[model samples]
Target: MTTTRSAADDARDLPAEPTAPWILVLAGGVVLLWLGVLAWQVAVLPERVPTHFAADGRADGWSSRNGALAFSALIPLLVVLPMPVLSRLVLWAPGQINAPNKQWWTATGPRLRRFERLMREDLWLITTVTLLLLVAGQVGIVLAARSGGDAMPTWILPVALVVFLVAIGAVMARMFIGGRYAAQPDLD
Candidate 1:
């Protein structure tokens, strides 16, 4: 005998995929990797530099400071690196709904639309922030070195500061444009 099912039965048959657990796992892994790298740097960096080697290790404080700044800049890159990974994981996972139903599309559509907008916004944001960090961090390292009586052949802090300011300005302009674009909700 053939059985006929109603719409309610069909919805009940549609499985809901859990996304939170995978998101949590991805976040936990990223955090743990960051902590591990930080711990390793703390534990082994001083040994290689040797505290007794120089006066307060000031012969080349720039290296340490620059390293610190570069490391800080890398944090953003590291955080963003997982986006593709998460996308892949979500794509590969079983029971994942590749497409949403009408209700979902109607309800969460705007949020998803905003998320897409933010993705475009982030490209400019990441470029600006990375460039700013690189310039400012180097300037900071140079200023620190010069302050510590370590004579560097070239003092480039002023130039670096200018570049940092320019990057900041560009970032502001891009953000303003993006905000304006996002304000007018276009149902495309």
Candidate 2:
């Protein structure tokens, strides 16, 4: 009898990925919504808008409305848009993945699938949180522009920053834990 490699085994050889988890799709949707909000805000912005904020949350510098819009759009595009590309890169080049006990993970089909699922989920989580933070930033920009050098709501940025940091850290830690699972012999 000849043994044949199953489709799952062949999957490892393919450059294409399986269907994305819902969270990744959700992250993409959120970014699209953010672009919509930015466009609406740009349409309403005055000719001159505050583009920089001081340590105290008051506007310290100004720019033309177009300049402010360009700055805001450029940042999230740079920061958030690369996530899916990197995720695909990792899938295509699993050799780049580092773990304390990667041998066990790559040893079997089930373990490898589990390892990949965790990686994809963690990536989507990171992307979603980053999108949220960027959206918050754009909201602050619009509010500051409306306020005309007035102080922003004092607690908002600090609180949001801390929350986003904690959330991302937790997701990263979960990814590390996947290594632990990978190192184990399968009980199945």
What RMSD, rounded to one decimal, does every model reach? 12.5, 4.4
Off by over 4 Å in 1: 1-111, 127-129, 135-150, 153-155, 177-182
Q: What C-alpha lDDT, on a 0 to 100 scale, does residue 181 get in candidate 1?
A: 29
Across residues 1-188, which tens digit of lDDT does each residue of candidate 1 receive?
A: 98974333333344432333543454455445545544544444421221111323244432463365446446546654434333322222313423223233223334333333333343434444444444343333344344445432233445555765786677566555545324334534
Q: Give the C-alpha lDDT of model 1.
A: 0.41
Candidate 2: stretches off by over 4 Å: 1-21, 108-114, 178-188
Worst 10 residues of 2 by lDDT: 178-187
| TM-score, cand. 1 | 0.35
Candidate 2 on 79-170: residue-level lDDT in tens?
76666456444344556668556665555555556566656666778877887777777777778777755556666678779879998988
As for candidate 1, its clashing pairs are: none
- The prediction achieving the highest TM-score against the true structure is 2
Q: Provide backbone clash counts, one per model.
A: 0, 0
